[model samples]
Target: MISFDKFYSLFQKNLQNLYKNSKEIESIFFLLMTHIFKCDKTTILLKLSKKGKIHFIIYKKLIKKLWELKKNKPIQYVIGKAYFFDMEFIVNKNVFIPRQETEELVYWILQDNKNTKNSQIFDIGTGSGCISITLKKKKPKIGHIYAIDFSQKIIDIARKNAKLHNVKISFKKVNILNSDIPIQKKINNNSIIIIISNPPYIRISEKKLLHPNIIQYEPFQSLFVPDKDPLIFYKKISFWIKKKLTGIVYVYFEINQFIYLDIIKFLKKIGFFNIKIKKDFHGFFRMIRAVYYKKK
Candidate 1:
């Protein structure tokens, strides 16, 4: 057994060579300790203040997790879960870990449709079902929610998350770029439809710019797009909305800040209007929302 303070010192020391920022290292340590201890950070700190001694078995587990972190594994994957919109989600290498910016996207959707009734939401490329599950949880009265992804493995992970959250989301294996939109023929004229996605927007060339942790641990299918057509997913989705969906539709996207202007232009060209861009906490334009009216 070792004193909590000493254990934390050892933990920080082992991570120092890999993580340069002291605060970041500390945050990682807290997440690991909380996961291992199955308690909140406040309780962990209280134990540390009282010189808590960690059992040898627990210490061994902590060391193993630390080693995983040192190998550039994402903390979320290392821990097997992530928190989004203040809810816990099951995550793994098969799915893209949820981002804080996406919470803003969810907030935007809920804000615009707070009083909406008989609405349907579709989450495209919904890895881990974070967006679709969250929207359903926040607005249980929404008529129906659907989420689709390319990989059955990814869809399975997303279904697990939906079950974990106890939210009903229709999960489907779909190659969004090639598969026919599954819900296209089910649209009800009087019902509002909201389509939202955080699709692959990072150009493959930008891979070098990302941290090894992200590039190494997250699924490439969820992250990278060909540089020749970084907007491919956006274009496909816009085309789907233009040709398939109808009547009082709203669309939201977690966008690449660098190409937001290009996205807005394309949406306008496809007849989506009332387009608005929202800046995330980092002050980058990371989300877009637009409205479309289709006459029957």
Candidate 2:
């Protein structure tokens, strides 16, 4: 017979060399191992006592997880899902996981768009389809929404998520790199009222400053652009706005805290008015909202 406390102590000790924060590492291992064993909170106590006697297959799977963590893969990727906007979505190497700050962007849209039954929204770089789907769900009255992405695998997951949640959306597979959305009029009879994006804004310089779990595990295409032109997406978005959005078309973006001032300035120069930058829970310059107003 094995002792629960003793085995846990050994495991924790072995992991200490891998993780500087011993308590968090221990917690991750405990919860993950228990789940791998199919033991809930009630059965976890005694299950540890029989660790060595556990099924070989489950042990092997958990050992694999530990090995991945030792090399710095995010636990969210390992688990194959992540929580966002108070909901769970399938996550993997193919697409970026939905983030909590992005949830705030969705909330802001929902709150501001109470009567969007007739308005049109275009979500550029619709990663995981979180923004587009949430908007459709929140304002079912909306005539239509266009969720654009350049990746097929991510668009596939987004379509699956939309189906799972029973929402209607048009997923467009097109690159927005340098396009000014030449077909804006064809897509909407009424003016496109809103444009939102949490584009790839992380520069190469900042990549070296991120957590190893994210730096190594998450896809660079989703998080970063070439450092030489970190604002590539923003520049294109502003061009689209200046040439396309008329009257009071609202624009929103999730930006790097360090570049908040720079983004706001560019928006102002491009005829964006009433621009605002919002901070996240960590008090970083995280979200920016702007309105495009063309001179009459």
Largest TM-score belongs to which candidate? 1
Off by over 4 Å in 2: 1-19, 22-54, 182-192, 294-296
TM-score per model over all chains: 0.97, 0.84
Shift of residue 102 alpha carbon in model 1, Å: 0.4
lDDT of 2 by residue, 141-243 (tens): 8657788888899889889888877999888887888455544444444554788899998988887788777877788889988877778899998897777
| Model 2 poorest 10 in a row by lDDT | 182-191
- Model 1: pairs clashing at backbone N, Cα or C within 3 Å: none
RMSD to the native, candidate 2?
3.4
